[model samples]
Target: MALFDRYLAGQLLVYFGFFSLVLVAVYWVNRAISLFDSLIAGGSSVITFLEFTALALPNVIYAVLPVSALVATLYGINRLSSDSEMVVAQTTGLSPWRLARPVLAFGLVVALMVSVLGHVLVPLSRTALAERGAELSRDVTARFLKEGEFLHPGRGVTVYVREITPQGELLGLFLQDRRNAAMRTSYTAERAILVRVDGTTRLVMFDGMAQTLQVEDRSLVTTTFQDFAYDLAGLAGGDDGARRRDPREMPTPALLRADAETQAVTRKDVAKLRSEGNVRFSEALFALGLPLLALGFLMLGGYSRFGLWRQILGAVVAAILLKMLANVTETAARDDAALWWTVYIPAILTLALGFALVWRDTRGPHLIRPRGDGAPA
Candidate 1:
């Protein structure tokens, strides 16, 4: 019995890895395209692109694990049935519940892995990723000086550049500042350059005109200047080099505790923090429930040449419905921490359904009445 359990569990683990690798590769490539564009726009090195994509991998893997588990279990079960191995085991006095023991164990293994990622790696990666993004946001040349494009890097500020010289000069630059609703300012320059002086980023606009509009009196004032210096970091608030941390970037313990400092720094209320904390655990718990759920559904069909297509389809639909339920519950929990238990409902339901399905299989095949058309006695 122990040998059989080991064999079954080993098969599941191997298949889980294969499926995870394949799926992660596909998903990661899709993510890499967007990463490439953003990294280039921010004047990041290829190394930075690789680093950002690597940081993003943990979250992608976290998302893909459940799907990989489901597919792996289904594949393992279907293969066992196709080889008549399941029939042999069952005929040798193993009931469906007994056969499911190894699958349950396999699910627990998956659950443990997911728990580690959720509690540790994912948050750390996200925090690192966010820090890198903020650092990129501080590059004035990339954020504000892109040539032949209009950019809005801050609230009520617009900048445009017609061309940029290889010698690092801006030609035909335009700037509009409307942060002060009552008084609007616009600047246009035939040539300009960026200079850093005394730990400050300054834009030197040459041969330009400054136009001010008074909204209250409908009056406009225009003045020409030989050169004008503007403090760019002040415009985008990037001078401070401070970034707000997201709740998801914090450790689970921190989120659950949600001290006054955490709340003030993250700008999230206690209820929402608690709800997010619970969600991480509940989501990790799905790793266990999902595989068992797939195994149970696949077990419903006897060995057949055509395969367990109907059961596989049913498993997919069930997984989708359960995921939808989880999302709905998560949204509700966010509204009030008192509803935090709702997030666990899907995990509970999945486990129950898995057990129920396997037990039903143990009940023997259901009998059906003969068709009336036969009219046999």
Candidate 2:
């Protein structure tokens, strides 16, 4: 029994690894294209792009593990059945439940890996990635300054620099601010400097003139000054202190023990945080249910020369339905904390279905009514 279990586990792991690698690569590449474009356009280095993509991998891995477990289990079971290994084991007095032990073990292994990613790695990666993005957006000197070209850093704001010195100086600077509908301002400075003050960026223009146009009255005002300051806090969507933290970036422990203060800065409310915390555990638990579900689907077919192709298709459909149910439950849970238990509905249904199938198989072949007038005379 131990040897057979080892063999089954070995087969499942091989398929699981293969499917996970392929899925992650496909997902990563699709995501990396967008990241590469955004980072490069923002004047970030290739190393920064690589780091951002790497940080995104944990979330992708977490998303793929349950599906990978389902595919690997289905493949392993179909291989054994096609090769008649399952039939030999069944005839030798091995029950359906006994055959499923190895599959259950495989499921548990996948569950552990997903748990680590969901509870730890994913949150850390997302937080780091967000911080990096915010930093890139705030890097005005590198991201916004280009000699002899007009740059629009944010909506309704355009800047043009005649030259950028190696000493980090901006010369022949032109700025236009139209963010305030009532007041339009323009500035032309011989030189300008970027400074950070009180966690916000300010453009300090030296020896410049400020021309203000009042849109309501069509009045124009001009002022001459040696120094002028323009607030840039809104340019990058806000500074680190002003940026709200996404719920996905919060640690599991924080979510579980979240207070009103903590919820204030997140995108969602307290109920949403609680629901998200429970979802992490539910997702991990669902991983342990998939293999059992797939094994049950395979066991129902016995050993047919015509093949268990129908059962395989049914298994795929079952997995899809389970995923849809999970998504619906998650959304409902987010809206109502009382519905948080819905997070476990899919897992419970899967386990129950698997158990029922195994019990039916243990009772021997099922009898069916004859069709097409070949009824039992």
Candidate 3:
């Protein structure tokens, strides 16, 4: 019995490793294709792209583990049956429950891993990735100033360049500021370079023309200079360097703390925050339930002798329905506290059904149905 359990576990481990690798690769490729444009737009480098993708792996593993477990179990059981191994074991007095024990253990292991990753690793990664994205967006925006295009960095400042080099050196630069209600200023330069000083950026124009429009008399006065500088303090907000933190990016502990702190906050803001927090918690718990669901499906697979493909199809459908049910329950749970009842109902149903099927199968046809005439006795 020990040897049989070890063999079953080994088979499941091997199948799970292979399936996880394949699924991760497929998911990575799909994400890369979908995010290529967004990454480029955000001015993310190869290193940034790799880091972002790596951070997403925890979520992917959580999503894919249950399905992989189901597939592997179905395949493993079908292989045993096709090779007559299951028949031999059955004849040797091995019950269906005994054969399923190892698979259930494997499913439990997967569930633990998913729970840890979903509750801990995923939140950390989400926070770090969001901060990185903000940094990349800032870098991209700073580098996007193009010649012959009016660049409005912020406020009422408009800058235009007749020509610019790859290094961002400007020629024939034009600038306009309409930030003041009483005054408007325009400057033209033969050459300019955008320079950063003391955490603020300024355009240093050389041999420029400057004009001031007086709003009082609608009069314009012009001047030329050998050198000039435009104060760009207002061009961008100083807090642009600050990172935005969404609740989803917060760790579970931090989110819990936040919820506690805001418990008395019953305004719309507090409700929104509470909803987000609950959603994250629910998602983490749902991920943990998936492996148990897979175990239940595996038990179901053991009873069907048609083939691996049929079992796989059934498991897939079951997993999809479980997820859909979870989503519906999660949405309801967010709106009404009483709706939390729906969250664990599917998991309970799955366990009950799986165990019932196993019990009926072990009891044989006579106990499960009428002995001969298909009528209840």
Candidate 4:
């Protein structure tokens, strides 16, 4: 019994590992192609491209694990059944439950690993990738700003350069601020240099003229200075450091903390946060449920006399429906707690059906004995 269990486990694990690699490779190629345009736009180096691709692996792995598990299980079981190995084992008094034990154990282990990755590692990787991408964008922008063009640094601010020296200095700099409509402020400089100050980049102008236009009284005040600095608040606002932390980018513990903090917020904000938190929790739990689902699917595949292609088709359809159901339940859970009931119901149904099938297959053939020389009992 122990040897048979080891054989079954080894067969399933080998196939699972192969399919997982294939899925990961396909996803990586697709992502790299999709990111090609962005790479060009960002002027990314080879190292940057490689780093981005590596950072994206967690999301790909999370998406592919369940499907690979299902496919590998189905294939492995079908192969055993087709070769009559399962039949021989059954004749030797190996019950369906006993045969299923190793596969279920394998599934549980995979599920736990996936759960940890989905709940912990995925969020961290996503946050790091986003931050790095933002930094790259900022660096690219600072290097690529052209002369003789009006640039909007960020909201409510505009900068115009009449010319730029070959050495990359601004020859004629003009900046406007309409942040306060009631008091428009404009600065002009004969020469300016962009510099970083206190973790923020600013434009320092030499021999510049300043204008203050007051809309309340239609008044204009002008002043001239030998040296002046314009620290555009808009630039500061554009810093990626100030960006909102998306719930998906937060670990489970941090998400819980955030939910607690937002309890005193407005009702709308509370609903939004609760919705996000519940969905995250559901997805994390779903990773654990996948192996159970895979086991059920494997039983169906193994017992069906339909051709291998048809069984494969059925498994594919089943996987699609399961995913669709999960997504629908997740969407609902975000808006209402009542929807969580829908999430676990499918898992329960699948488990029950799998157990019933396995029981009937293993016991039905032995329950009734030939009676009275093939006559009625």
Writing each residue's lDDT as its tens digit, candidate 2 over 133-182 gives: 77777877676567887777667888889998887678999999999999
User: Could you tell which candidate, 2 or 3, scores higher by lDDT?
Assistant: 2
lDDT of each: 0.84, 0.84, 0.65, 0.67
Candidate 4, residues 73-174, lDDT tens digits: the string is 878877887898877887899877897787776676667657766787787888888887767655523532466766654546677878878777887888
Q: Where is model 3 more than 4 Å wrong at Cα?
A: 140-168, 171-191, 195-244, 254-308, 365-377
Candidate 1 TM-score, C-alpha based: 0.83
lDDT of 1 by residue, 1-377 (tens): 88999999999999999999999999999999998886665445688789899999999998899889999999998898889898788889988877889999999888888888888889999999888776665666666657777776566878898998998899999999998989999999999998888766889999999999999998999999999998877663566645778998888888889899889878898878888899888877887888888877887744446678878899999999999999999889888878988999998999899988888777754421123434343
Top-TM-score candidate index: 2
Query: Residue by residue across 258-377, what tens digits does model 3's lDDT show?
Result: 455443332223334445555554544444344444444444433334544554566568767877876776566557654555666555555555566566566653432223465466
Question: What lDDT is obtained when candidate 2 is compared to the true structure?
Answer: 0.84
Alpha-carbon RMSD of each model: 4.2, 3.7, 7.0, 7.5
Candidates' TM-scores?
Answer: 0.83, 0.85, 0.69, 0.69
lDDT of 3 at 229: 73
> Which 10-residue window in model 3 sums to the lowest lDDT?
263-272
Off by over 4 Å in 2: 145-162, 172-190, 205-228, 240-243, 265-267, 365-377
Model 4, CA-based lDDT:
0.67
By TM-score, how accurate is candidate 3? 0.69
CA lDDT, candidate 3, residue 308: 47
